[model samples]
Target: MSVRARGTLGRFLLTLLVALLALGMPLAPANADPTVGPAQDEPLPVTVNLTKITPTFADSSTPVHVEAELTNTGDETITELWIRLQRDQWISTRAQLQIVDDQQPPYAWAMSAPTSLSAPLDPGDSMSVTLTVSRDELVMYDAGAYPILLNVYGTVDGWENHVGQAAFTMPHADQRPDTPLGVSWVLPLIDQPRRVSGTDVFTDDTLATEISSGGRLENILDAAEEYGEQAKISLVVDPALIDALDAMSDGYQVRTDTGNIDGAGAEAAASFLTRLTDVADTSAIIATPYSDVDAVALVRAGMPEVLSDARTYGADIITDVLDTDPITNIAWPADGIMTDDTWQTLVADGVDTALLSGASYGQEDYLESPLGITESASTVLPNGRAIVADPGLSRLLTAAPQYAGGPVPAAQRITAELAMISLQMPTEARNVVLAPPRDWAPSEQLLDDLFTTTTNADWLTPMSLQQVSEGPPVDRGPLQYPATLSEQELPGNILESFAAPLQQVAELGSAFDPEDTDEALWPTRAALFDAASSAWRGGDGSAVSNGLDTANDALATLRAQIHIVTPSDGTYTLTSSDAPLVFTIENNLPWDVHYRIGIDESRSVGLTAEDVGVQTIPGGTRATVQLPTSVERSGAFTVVAQIRTPDGDPLGNDVQINVSSSAYGTAALWVTGIAFTALLALIARRWWRRHLFWAEERRKRADAQAHQLREDAGDHGQHEYRSDDAIVPPDFAGYDVPPRDEHR
Candidate 1:
């Protein structure tokens, strides 16, 4: 091969082998190291990250350990790599030097032998190394924070430079501030209880496991056990979860998609509740409103009644269930943002404090909230106080350790940042608050390591909410919340729209409740609150939407049960007008319902009857009501049946009946029969009178003829002998000439 071609082949072959090493494959049997190929402005083809620095504040006697990880970012294999720790006395603090020049330091601390890489690191491959500086070699004369740099020297084809820095503190005479660094570690022990459709029963065992022996909840318990009464660390809890556990204490049925299953999760949940109560006794417990209600949304949706109920009554409900007095005067809205109206409403509802986001304090830059500045203060509302959490510190405290090189490294970074806060204000002590992520999932080991590091940090003095509340306040800007309230408004409107029927259900169920504490209806109320949970953050809003759908389904079912029962075809028939229009009211609900049944005026059918006032129907029973209705010449008519609450609010849907009345009334038949009898008698009398008159006329005629015959018998009396032997004339059967002469 030509020289140039051979060189290209050599580079390609080396890269191929390094790729294999990155994939944990065997390398090719070629000269692994080649002479320097080309020069670039950036020396090293590797990235060195100083993962951690142990003993951040150490004396000469304490061993100084520097740990870092080096990754080969270049395509070629890293044939040689070395890490060196350097110290510069000219730069006492971390902020002094922004850039590192090629100029050598004026004063250099004693150097240790560079830690060598164990094996060649392939491209995209990383190796961790620990560099140590012995106490005999390094000495510290002053007590202050010092800047230390990790210089990485690596060779691909030639040597290159990569660098990072960390701060080290050597306390003066091992002395921290006499007042101590006031710190507040707020741990959130919250879980959104599962709200499945068509159920008031607590059934999921996974929830139980999460609160059981080795779950995330157990980590908080362990912290509580370790921290004892260190007043500064607080625990914020969701009451809905506690209520769910209380319900699950007995054998419970967990709802599944297909059906329900008998679950053993409740036992574990009960155990967790007991443990939580114990923790509450020792630590400050902040009970959130049941299900973490979305106050802003409720206010925007014009549901001040619901918002008031959640804030004012949640504390009592939680206390009764948990048997512990949690701080209920404080309100924590979702995303820690509430509009002015919502805030004022909460204040009116007896909320004295509100936990808000840094954004509420006009701090758009999450991490830049002024801690040491005297002007850093919480805003004051009409009847409440708003405390803005340091968003940066809160994020850093809860940041996943893996994202920041591991727990220890992340902890060290946290310590360094905290130390800088004190360093910035050596004479004054400031209160720093740390709120972990709302839905934090921490490993036991990680939690232990973090708490150990934090509690032992000489500069930090952990304070509880009670203690922090007593501290001096800082001056802050006006209250500010996110302009968008649509998310909250939508769900709130949904709940409001269904509120009346739900309230009726609650009242109805409560009446029949054997326990009489409203516990029977609490699950449904909790579900409504669940549907409005602020935990439904950015996304498609499926969580809240699903919750709303579930609630609507439940309410719809409840309303359906208290309705006018009709045929499958939704029609009714009246065989007789006398048979009062009778229909059945089916109360499918589990409690008695007092409802009024009446005709809908909008119907085309004319029906008249006394109003069927409120009737109490026992739950799960069917009752028939007979309404005396008069149909006006009806072959077919539409009867619109209305079912309503005692207050006249519509329930369910209006039932329509196609009624056909085929029976006649008795009074009208009697009157027609009497009139027909009278007319028949009158006609018979007239016929009798006419017949009598004709008979009499005939008799008179006969007598007249007999007299004539007597007079004529002497002359011609043959026709006068007998009435049956009458002679007939040709024109008039007797004597037409004689009759005519008599008439004349």
Candidate 2:
């Protein structure tokens, strides 16, 4: 080899050593520092997963994941080669990082995004590779070693050896791992913060009379104060009116839903609540500013631990309060809802569980809402179903939009806001305690005032919190919001235009909105995983054995979904069918589903054209269709059935029936065979005779008559034939009738 060629070979040898060292492959001729060319082989880079290493939490020796790129870096193609840890004692061969990056930050949430090689690398090439190495794993696996060694080998380049060195450290990826949190809030409409009992009333309805809304607010705020140490709150209200809240509660008198208190007039309900807050040792006045943090480097920022509970505070979304704290617990109050950025934030925080409450009380839907879960990856909220907000939360958020700064806010203002936001609330049997329609709450005078004055936004429609000319706080609470609502339900004359929020919270209740406020103002989330590991009852009992076999079969074949009998604490509901589709829903947690089935029918298209009876298979039985006798015994038939929820949704799809023909289904084979033979014989007999028997006899009789006619014929061309009796002589019975024909 030339001088340059020798150099290339030398470099190849060096890389070979590194590859072998990283892969932990044994070097041939153990005594030699560098092996010869014959054993040198090319090396292919492989990613090493560390999840299997199972770090004993906080063990420094346990590394998260170790990986390296070893291309032929030389002029050789790599084949199957041994790649293992440099020293078995330093790193485990079982390490795996099967989890993806987007799946989660460090919480129980599943990884949403996948990890992949940016591009293919070649010799004299480079590739950026990454792995999730748990700090504890590195510490545990390395023990006293500060750096971990990985080896890669290629037999062609055994002359060269090199090892990839990786440093050990773990980032605090997960912050609030205990729960996925959210804010619940209520908007006070009476414009006062006074706590009323069941009986108080302003006019005839509960707004003036009911105290549940106000009391719920205090309870929610207190809970947050206790649980939300790392949480920040966005309180929407007019800066000038916060003090008025106390006057509404000054009397400290017992509240009755039936009658209004004598002194609780509306000038400002502050003195009323001030006394109450003092009793609860409430600190609304002494409360600190809400907090915020950059999710990327949470640890370096000196941030407190994330809150582990759900908490909320009531806000008056009218202009004043929002002007000061535009981004309160509720982020974007647009079109009565918003869910824009809440999910992203929660995932970053490492939340595992999420709960969603309905917004409108009377307008609740039977189906669980998707809750904007479609926008977020499944890693954070597994399966994406959430609890609905209670009726209580709806009543509170309704008043904020209407209460914004107004010289004389009309009752219709409150009603309009109420109606728009009540679309998603829960129900209480027949009675739906929903927000009132636009004109429903206005007084006669207010109606007249609305028509005459167009100064404050169109009275016909409600304004979004974001549209109120106030920007949000640095760390605004996100509300579940929608980009827009269908205009079909709105009044065309109400306004020239209305633009809704760009995003909305999922049915689970959180969004990326600048003005979204929720009831209770504070909420948390959690995620837990449990496998059907014990599908086979460990104990040997009749129920256990039968149940296990059923479960095992169910898992093996997804013909049915395993539903846990709900509210039983620990239970399952196995709904099975040989059908292709199944659907259902369960809000209850801590459950896993599996199913089993056997075909009851032999075909997909069941054809009993003669009988139109509905097909019925026993519940829990698989599907089957009988093969048509008209079709050959060797023919096949398809069977189909769909599984669905009580409300009708496909579940465990891809199930089907494929029929194989056999003699077992043919009961009348012998009879059919005999009948078929007989029919064939009859057809053959008719074909062989040429159908001449009837014609031959008729032809013979005609010939006899014609013979008689010959005797009577005068002319062969025009003769009229006569019967033998007539053509022959009177005494000649068989003679021809030639004499009679002559006269004709």
> Against the true structure, whose lDDT is highest?
1
Per-residue alpha-carbon lDDT of candidate 2 for residues 37-134, written as tens digits (9 for 90 to 100):
12124322332222122121223344445444443344443333433332212211111110111111111111112234334334454443444544
Off by over 4 Å in 2: 1-603, 606-635, 660-693, 704-730, 733-744
Question: How good is model 2 by TM-score?
Answer: 0.20
Q: Model 1, poorest ten-residue lDDT window?
A: 27-36
**Looking at model 1, how many pairs of residues clash?**
10
For residues 457-516, write the lDDT of model 1, one tens digit per residue: 677777766555556655465677655633534444355554654566555552333553
Counting only residues 3 or more apart in sequence or on different chains, how many pairs clash (N, Cα, C under 3 Å) in candidate 2?
201
Deviation from native of the Cα of residue 722 in model 2, angstroms: 2.4
Q: Could you tell me which residue pairs clash in candidate 1?
A: 203-253, 203-254, 231-464, 232-463, 232-464, 377-474, 712-716, 713-717, 728-733, 729-733
